[model samples]
Structure formats: structure tokens, C-alpha cells
Target: MSAAEVSVRRRRGSFGRLFASEVHLVFGRRRNQVGLLVLFGLVTMLGVALKVSAMRHPGDRGGDLFSLVAGNGVFLGFAGLTIEIALFLPLAVSVLAGDAVAGEANLGTLRYLLVAPVGRGRLLVVKACALGVGALTGAVLVALAGVLVGVLLFGAGPLITLSGSQIGLGDGLLRLLLAALYVAVGLAALGMIGLFISTLTEQPIAATVATAMVSTLLWILDAVPQLDWLHPWLLVDRWSAFIDLLRDPVFTDRMVTGLWVDIAYGAVFLFAAWLRFRVKDITS
Candidate 1:
């Protein structure tokens, strides 16, 4: 074989190795899988309750099945991503991100990987990206399950928002897609916070639990009436701002501001994580 052919094969193998490692590390995780199962069960229970209620109240009025599933309930059930992220996504992201370095550090395998000539920053980047992907996956699964449950309980039809605006079937579907993408962005910051917390402790549980507690407590504080002044700046409070999509006029002003706030937080959290990472010493 020519020398060029051998080099080409070597690079291909490296890429595959990296990709496979990420997949295995994510899916092989017992916590990730268990968390998903629990979410699915919750959705099933909610769907059954909805179905029973609808049967009991035939006099109720609202949009058709399609609209009910994809539109009204999705928005009204802001819990779709909003409440889920507050109560659960953080826990899932924390488990993965919290273990990113600390898990390896605890097991003594991080040292060998570092000695393989890879830069610390590069390793951190790969690990962070992997954890973020895991988090996004969990969020999407919950969204899909919730939408499905909502549809079965209600009928499918055009979606009507509280703003009195109507979105056609196609538009509603696309909006759902956008909503999913936005959710990933929101969770990405939390993942970084977890990653940063992980670097400070050798115990994986400490980092994971701390990230969930800190984010949730701050989110509650942002909701407190007396703390209205701090709402705009709170990382968790801004996520619900996407509900502007449901507005009749689709308020671009507030939407744009909310998005920018999310971007700013993403930047701030990532920078903070990286800063701590650069200073952390794993050589010990």
C-alpha cells in the first residue's frame, strides 16, 4: 500500500474512534436511560388523565384535535420545556456534565488521555459538546412525548394562540421545530454551569446536585413578585419569554430582547467554564 493511503486510513480511524466514544459514553449511561424512561411514564399518566377528562366533559369547547395537540395545549402547558427544564433537564445535564471531568479524574483515566498529546482546551471542548448533546436529546424526547399525549387527548386541527392568532398545520409544525431548537440553546448554558461546577470537586454527585439546586432556586427567586427587577437578567426566567411566539402580533421587540439575553448568558457561562478549566490542575 502507498504511504498516502495509510495516512488517509489513519485519519479516518481517528474520527470514527472519537465519534464512537461519544455515542457510547452518552447512551451507555444508566442514568440517562433511566431518566428518559421516567419521563415517558409521566407523559403516559398525563395522557390517560386528559383522555378521561375529555370523555367526562363532552360539552367543553376548543380547537380541533390537531390544534389542541400542537397549539393551545403546547403553549398553555408551558411545562413542555419551561417546567421540565426547571425540574428535570438540569438534573440530567448535571449528571452528564458533572461527570465529564470529575468522573474521569476519579477513575484516574483522565491522566492517560491528557498524556496522549491532546491539549487541555481541546479535551474540554469535546467533553462539553458531548454533554450538551446528551442534554438536548433528553429535552427533545420529553417534548415529543408531551406533544403526542396532548394530541391523543385533544384532536388535530389548526392551532389558535392566546393572542387570537391562528397558525396553519404546517406553520405550527415548523414552530414546534423552532421551539425545540430554542430549548437546546437554553439548556446549553446550564450544561456549562454543570461542567464548571464539576471541575471544582472530585465527587460527581456534588457537582450535579449543586447545578440543579442553584439554577432552580434562582429561577424561583426570579418568579418572586418582589424580585421583578431582577427577572430580566435571570438565566432561567428568560426561557419562558419564547411564549411571545404565541402572541397574536408576534411581538418581535420582546422576543428579540429575550433571545439576546439567552445569547449573552450562553457566552457568559461558557467563558466562566473555560476560565476555570484553564486554571484547574488535573496533573495532581
Candidate 2:
């Protein structure tokens, strides 16, 4: 191969190695492993509870699937997603993202890693990819566990929507996956926020708490009765809007808005982090 071709191939290989190393570092820890196990366990418990509840109230199938169990097996994914989007999944992501940089610096590994043959920008990119992978994995695990348990316990059938519309099993499963994707995207933005905070301190725990506290505060502000003006622009304002996908006609305005909001946040925060880390004085 020509020199140019060889250069491109080498770059690709280097990035692949970087990404693999980053993923290993992020998830190889005991705490991260336990966190993932806890997430799956909680979702599993939720599925069992929903199955029992459905059996107890066979004639009480009501409410939208996204917000309630609705006594239907197919809707169980939405039920689990509803809980995860608000807390569990995001918390898992925050723990990883918050430690991406600060944890390495605290352990006195950041300086050594920088001494390797990788650029700072590329290092940040690999870290972001690792965080995204973790967030997406957490999301898919909840959905998959919910679906598996939901089908086994309650049995799968047509999905009933909020508008009293029935969706076929195939289409229902597809929509469920889309809803999970939406949750993953929203959590990715939160991961960026954690990454940004990680750049500001050497204490991973502090960064994690700060990220979670900021997210909780945003949720609180979104709920205030008089924060109407800020509601439209808040990061968590449209997280649950993924439920619109379940509509017969598919109301996508909110989902579209939510995606753009996530994109904007991801861009702004990731850039800020890169800028900070690029000039940071690593004394550790």
C-alpha cells in the first residue's frame, strides 16, 4: 500500500485500540460492575411486579403504556423505561462520565496516559465514546430485561396506546426499541455534563455528585409552576416526550425538539470539556 493508505490504516487501528482501552478502563472496576448488576436487578424486579399487578387487575387495563403497566406484557418495556429515564440509567451514566477524567487524574494516571502517543483531543473522543457505550448498554439492558420478563410472565400481545389504539406486535416492538433509543440519547447528554464537571476537579465522587445534583435541580426547575419560560429550554424538559412515538399518528414534534436539545447540550458541553482539559495543568 501507498504511504497515504498506510497512514489511514494506522490511524484507524490506533483509534480502535484507544476505544477498546477506554472501554476497559471505564467498566473494569468493581463499582461499575455492581452498578450495572443493580440496574438489571431493579428492572427485573419491576417486570415481576408489573406481571403480578396485571394478573391482579385483568379488567383494569387503562392509561398510556409509557406511564403505566396497563396490564399488558408489551407495555412493560415502557414501564421500565419510564423509571430509568428519570433516575437509574442516568445515575449509572453519571458515575462513569464523572470519573472519566477526574478518576484518572486522582489515581495519578492521567499524566502517564498523556505521555503516550495519543493527542489530548483523541483521548477525549475515546472517553466520550466509552461513556456513550455505557449509557446505551444500560438503556438496552433495561429494555431487553423488561421485554424478556414481560413476555415470559405476562405473555406478549397487541399493544394498547393512550388513544385507545391497538398496535400489532411487530410494530409495537419496533416502537419500544425507538423509545429506548430516545432514552439513550437523552442520557448521552447528561454524560457530557458529567464529563465537563470531571474536567474541573480531581475528585471523581465530587464530580459525580455535582453532575447528579445539577440534573436533579434541572428536573425540579422544570416542574416549578411559574418556570414556564425556562421549561422549554431545560435539559430534562422533554425527556419523557418519547412517549409521543406511541401515538397512532406519531406526534414527533417533542421528540424532534428533544433530539435537538440533546445535540446542543452535547456539543456545548463536550467542547467546553475539551477546551478545559487541553489547557489543564495536571499536577497529579
Candidate 3:
């Protein structure tokens, strides 16, 4: 068509290429692959253990959510997610987000990337989006692996809700997907915080550790009885809100609050990352 239209198409193509390259850089690394494998392995092991426990003690119950796993395979996914959101999932996010900027700088490639035609803001956005993709991928994999293992070991059917109600397989699977998405949103918000930390340091390891510590610290603060007043504001406070999805009526209040909290955290930290990177000198 017109010259302007051609230029617009070219720009879109360039951005798509850049984003694809970033995704490759994040997932193509051997370490990231191993991290994902570890996550899957852990979830699978949990499912197997639950199966053995059910065989040994058919009448015994484990815990609130876990107790349902032996009877209905769908609960394994929920239980796996609960265990993951406590630490493993956030650690996965930290690894990717912390390396988004600091890893490139450590390799002395940050300056070279800046020399290209791409603006710093655009590059940062691409990096953030890539981190989000990585986070979602990890969360979804855990849930899926849990479901597969649980179904094979225990068999799938209707899910027993916490309120002594039952839901069909279709509706239960849908809730599992929603729980995975909810957890992914929280991990994405944590990734943004890691992105901001990555902007401040050249050591990717340090950034990774620091970002993980932020989550751990929040969890510790949230666990304190005296801090109950401040619990509502902590990023990690409502991480387990996905459990509400298993209820009969499906409690939306906590999940909605958690979603907004995640959004606010993501917006604030992403802006901080942008503002810092906008002015920082590229010495590498």
C-alpha cells in the first residue's frame, strides 16, 4: 500500500522478531530447562506419594485440600499449585526476571544491544513480556503435570468441594485452569519487582537472590500474628486465594483483591524499572 503503511508493517515485524529472540534467550538456556524439569519432577513426586499414601491408609486424611486428592484426581492440581505458590513458582520467576537485564550486562552485551536501533523502553518492555511468558509457562506446566500424574495414579471423576458438594469433571478442570492463571498473575507481578532489581545490579545471581528474598520476607511478615493488620497489603498475602475456587459458591472476593494487588505491584515496579533504565549509563 502507501509508504507509511509499509513502515508500520516493518516496525511490527521488528518487534515480533525481538520478542521471539527474547523468548528463545530465556527458555533456550540449559539452566532454565533444568529448572522447569525440577518443577515438574517435584509435582509428579507429590502425586505419586499421595497415591501410595491412599493405598496404605485408605481411610486416613492428609490435610484440608490434600485429603480430597485420593478420592478425586483434580485436587492434585490444586494441591500442587498451593505448594508451588509458597516458594517454587516464585523462585522460577526470580531466575528469569532477575536475569532480564543484569545477565546481559554481565555478559558485556548490554552496550551492544543499546547500540542497535531499538529504544531502551521497547527493549525493557520486551524483556518484561518475556518474563511474564516464562512465569506463565512454569505455572501452567506444574498444574498440568499434577493433573496428568494424579489422573493416571488415582483416576479422574467428579471433584468433591470443600463444602461437601460435588462438581463435574468439566467444571473442575476449568477451576484448575483458573487457579493456574491466578497464580501466574501473582508470579508476573513478582517478576516485575525482579526486573526493577535487575536494573540496579550487574550480578544476575545477586539480583535473583534479592528478588527471591523479597518474596520470602513478605511471607515471613505475613505469617506474624501482630502483622495481621498489615497482611492485606503484602504481595504474598493472598497467594493461596486460589483455594477459594474449590468452594461450592466460589469465593471471588479474595481472588479479586489479590488480582488488584498484583496489578498495583506490577505497575509500580515496572515503572520504577523503566525510570531507572531510562537514565542509567551503559558502561559495559
TM-score, model 1 to reference: 0.83
lDDT of each: 0.69, 0.84, 0.91
Positional deviation of 22 in candidate 2, in angstroms?
1.1
Candidate 3 lDDT, 160-271, residue by residue in tens: 8887788999999999999999999999999999999999999999999999999999999999999899999999899899899989999999999999999999999999
lDDT of 2 by residue, 42-128 (tens): 877887776677667666655656335544566777778888777788788889987899999999999998998888988998888
TM-score of each: 0.83, 0.94, 0.97
After superposition, the stretches of candidate 2 with alpha carbons farther than 4 Å from their true spots are 64-70
lDDT of 1 by residue, 9-127 (tens): 87567555764686688788797789888766666565666566657775575753323433344432334555476777767777887778778778777788778655676677777
Error of 3 at 182 (Å): 0.5
Instruction: Tell me the lDDT of model 1 at 15.
Output: 50
Return the lDDT, model 1, position 20.
Answer: 67
TM-score of 2: 0.94
TM-score of decoy 3: 0.97
Q: In model 3, state the lDDT of residue 127.
A: 93
lDDT for position 218 in model 1: 75
Q: Is candidate 1 or candidate 2 better by TM-score?
A: 2
